[model samples]
Target: MSNKTPTLSVTIRTGRGKGAARRARNEGLVPAVVYGHGTDPQHLLLPKLELNTILRNYGLNAVIDLDIEGTSQLVLARQVDVHPLRDYVEHIDFLVIRRGEKVVVDIPVLVEGTPMGGTLTVQEASSVEVEAEAMHIPESIIVDVENAEAGTLVTAGDLNIPSGVTLVTNPEYAIVAVNEAKSAAATEDEIEGDAEGDATEAADE
Candidate 1:
């Protein structure tokens, strides 16, 4: 994760219910709640545009320093609710977090390098869950295939995760595999069969 934690200034919302939420949206604000650590959930209003930009730049699990009316609180963007047909963020749920606290997050898995000739690499899982300090969450985990032979399988446990991060995903889970590439002759035969089927359909018509 990037070391830069952007700060957002938000205000506590006193109004409740759908009417108040709708009014907030009309005013270019997003209704949100912050709750964690055995505290009461705080209702707040955040700038819609600013929050969207932050999420786009920092990702869904982005951590932020929330300036709630004057008090500063570190939080994680735990959940986001988007309008189904409008495609805009409607509400957000923030989780209050501490620097050293461990949080479970899904990190992207990237496969690097090419497999041996006549073989192709297939990624079985795109992301894996990991538990890491709130301040030290990694951007992603990489698994190198590098000239691997056919039938080679890479599992979650084989990943070279960064120090201080623990994999929450099952160690036996397959992440990627190298498989034999289909032969050109086999593809051609399938194409010929499709053409023959088309010709028979035309005759029937």
Candidate 2:
């Protein structure tokens, strides 16, 4: 978790429509809306390059200080829409937040070290949900598998989350498990069988 909050400069969006959105993008802006705290939604335009840079550095769970015109508001990124082919941000939804408020968020799970005895590690969940102070959200939760043996199971409850964070995910949900590694001969045989099956299907077609 980082204590730093990236700041973004934004302006009130005056127009609404695909054409307006297209024009905003053409001018290197991203269309976004901010809503929460019993307030009306505010449509705004953000600098595309600056927003991308912030996301790249802080991930999706980033807390940002939105400097709209001259007033500042603290917010959390609730949703983001991206261009599938071009991979650029198309739109964003931000949630207004206050200091010291606890927010529920999904933090990425990271595996550390390797399992022992030539076992293969299977990750069942890539992220876990937790409730924490909106200003103190963790970047990721790490699961240590150092010297773990086959048949070892790591569950969400086994994770060591930072203090002030409460687990919101089911405690028994499996995060990672170690299984016996497949032999090279077995892998080769499986591949051969798959190839034969594909050929037979092709012949039928």
Candidate 3:
């Protein structure tokens, strides 16, 4: 949950095309691009292990400082492309940001406390969009369901956001809801009964 920006070492990349990208991967480097802020896109190469470690520790919304041959740039991870089956980072798209700048990002929604009255709490949205300072983004928005009764609904408007953050999601959008828990055994029995009745009708026909 730390807002501290991580600094990564990157190098300018000159090669292009699929063969070049494959060669970079074979050498344990990830191809990435830095863009935005009225600047031309810069193709770069990053260490595979270091990039993965930062992403794993800080999550996708992490704002990081890239040290490119001694020059530093503050950027946010906008999009990440990963290898389909190998779970490795293939490419990343970064957006440049400045201090005090507000950016829209999707923040994870966390549920706290269980609903009352033997009800089951179901999450409708796992994340919500918000606008916050690029360097001060909140880790996640928490939804407190303590003592919530069956049929209780929590909407985007009900979320408690930190000061200086603005909710971009629709206020009426449902985030979570409480409903009575259904008996799994009973449901299984009903399905079995329906199947037997269908079989009997087919035999009679």
Candidate 4:
């Protein structure tokens, strides 16, 4: 994660309900709510393009400094709702957070390097849950499979987690595995074997 923090200036939304939210979108703004730390939910309007840019640069767990009508509040982009057909951001839920606070988030897993010849690397898990400081959350975890032999299993415990980030997922959770790639003939044989097994089972019955 980069040390730089993204800032967004927004205004408190006055209107309510679906009508207001639709109007905000028509004006290129996304309706959002901020709530956390036992505070009442505050409705706000965010720039659609700016919010998308921040998420693109920092990922879903981006920590943002929201300038709400001249007051700055530290927050996390906790949830986002998007239009299923139009593919635009509809609403967002921001969670208020403080500096040095521990937050649990699911970080994406990235595979690096290439496995040994004739073996293919298969990702078993896409992301893992971890707890880290609000400002120091890692964007993703990397697993190196360079020259890895077939049958080598990479578990969550094997991930290269940065210091200060505690893994919340089970240590035994499988992440990736190196396996021998199957050839066309081998695939055909498996299909034939299944068919024969079905016939034998029917005869026995």
Candidate 5:
């Protein structure tokens, strides 16, 4: 895993109309808002092409070094709004954070290895609610599923936490479990039924 970070330089924009926003996008910049630490909300323009590349690989918690008109700040990605079908970004919200500050963020849970005999079903895909420092937030939480027997279950409390991190979710939430798969014959029956229905419609046509 690489520990490289992305650096971005932004310029503050005072215009607040649709025309002003369109001009920024035409020039390959994105309209963004920055707010935190009792300061007023600052309208910012970021280089969209570069910021998109960084966010694509790093997810929502990516950190950025932002420069607004020669002023530098360390910030964390907070929220983003994008077009439903277009590739353009509609807006982005960045939270300015200081080092050593305790920031609460959700970390994704990754299951390692298959359950014993490949007979397990993931009851829940993700576990929510966690707290960590602004700079020490983990990329993800790993849950070991190696050789787990039937009737075995893993919960959010079973997660291993690194230093400077804490779990804030319910301790009893089921994250993964072992179960018997539905018989292949049962699946085939459903498929066959659907096929027959399709054929009947074609005949009617």
Candidate 6:
């Protein structure tokens, strides 16, 4: 909701190979790569402690104000390679970014509220792909199904794009839909229970 952008600072590590990464990890640094915008992929190292702290607060999209050996660059998170077995930053990829540059990214959609006593089904026809300015990407889109009736459906074309955001997903794509909850049919056990209740009431008369 806030317009403030998040940033982190890191350093350049020219070392390569498993041993080099292990040493960097031991020294509290993360192995990373900087690529995109037709530039050569630069292998770098980031401060593990500082990056972890920022990610813990800002999530995956945390921007970096990388100070690689005192040269500063603005970048947006692109990919994060992790160790499947442990809590370590195996590698990271950052996309070089400049103001007013449009970048495509997928944003999650959250649906709130349910049709009364009915099953609210999520039929996500498409994930939100938008081309937004590098510095102005939105976090998540909020969709309200609050008290929406059965048979009602919401589609991408129906979505209201936030200011400065452009939709890349197909307009005809379905986002979600509401339907009637399934009703339970009378079973043998239910019939027996009703008979028992009737018999008990009759006997009490």
Question: How high is each candidate's TM-score?
Answer: 0.81, 0.90, 0.88, 0.92, 0.80, 0.77
Tens digits of per-residue lDDT, candidate 6, 130-183, equal 888877777777778888888888988787778988889887888988877655
The most accurate candidate by TM-score is 4
Please give, for residues 179-204, the per-residue lDDT of candidate 2 as tens digits: 88988999999999999999999999
Model 5 per-residue lDDT tens digits across residues 1-205:
1245668889998889999999888888999998899888899999988888878777667777787878888788778888889956788999988877878877788888777773756758575678887776788888887778778888888788777688898878888787766578978999999999999999999
Worst 10 residues of 1 by lDDT: 53-62
lDDT (0-100) at residue 151 of candidate 1? 98
- Per-residue lDDT over 48-121 for candidate 4, one digit per residue giving the tens place of the 0 to 100 score: 89989999999889999999989999999888887899888899999999998999999999999999998989
Give lDDT: candidate 6, residue 171: 79
Better of 1 and 5 by lDDT: 1
| Residue-by-residue lDDT tens digits, candidate 1, 147-174 | 8999999899999989999999999999
The TM-score that candidate 6 achieves is: 0.77
> Model 3, stretches more than 4 Å misplaced?
1-3, 189-205
lDDT of residue 85 for candidate 4: 100
For candidate 2, the per-residue lDDT at 115 reads 80
Clashes of each: 0, 0, 0, 0, 0, 0
Considering summed lDDT, which 10 consecutive residues are worst modelled in model 5? 1-10
How much is 22 displaced in model 2, in angstroms? Answer: 1.7
Better of 1 and 2 by lDDT: 2
Cα deviation at 133, candidate 4, in Å, is 0.9
Give Cα distance to truth, residue 61, candidate 1, Å.
1.9
Model 3 C-alpha lDDT per residue in residues 164-200, reported as the tens digit of each score: 9999999999999998876889779999999999999
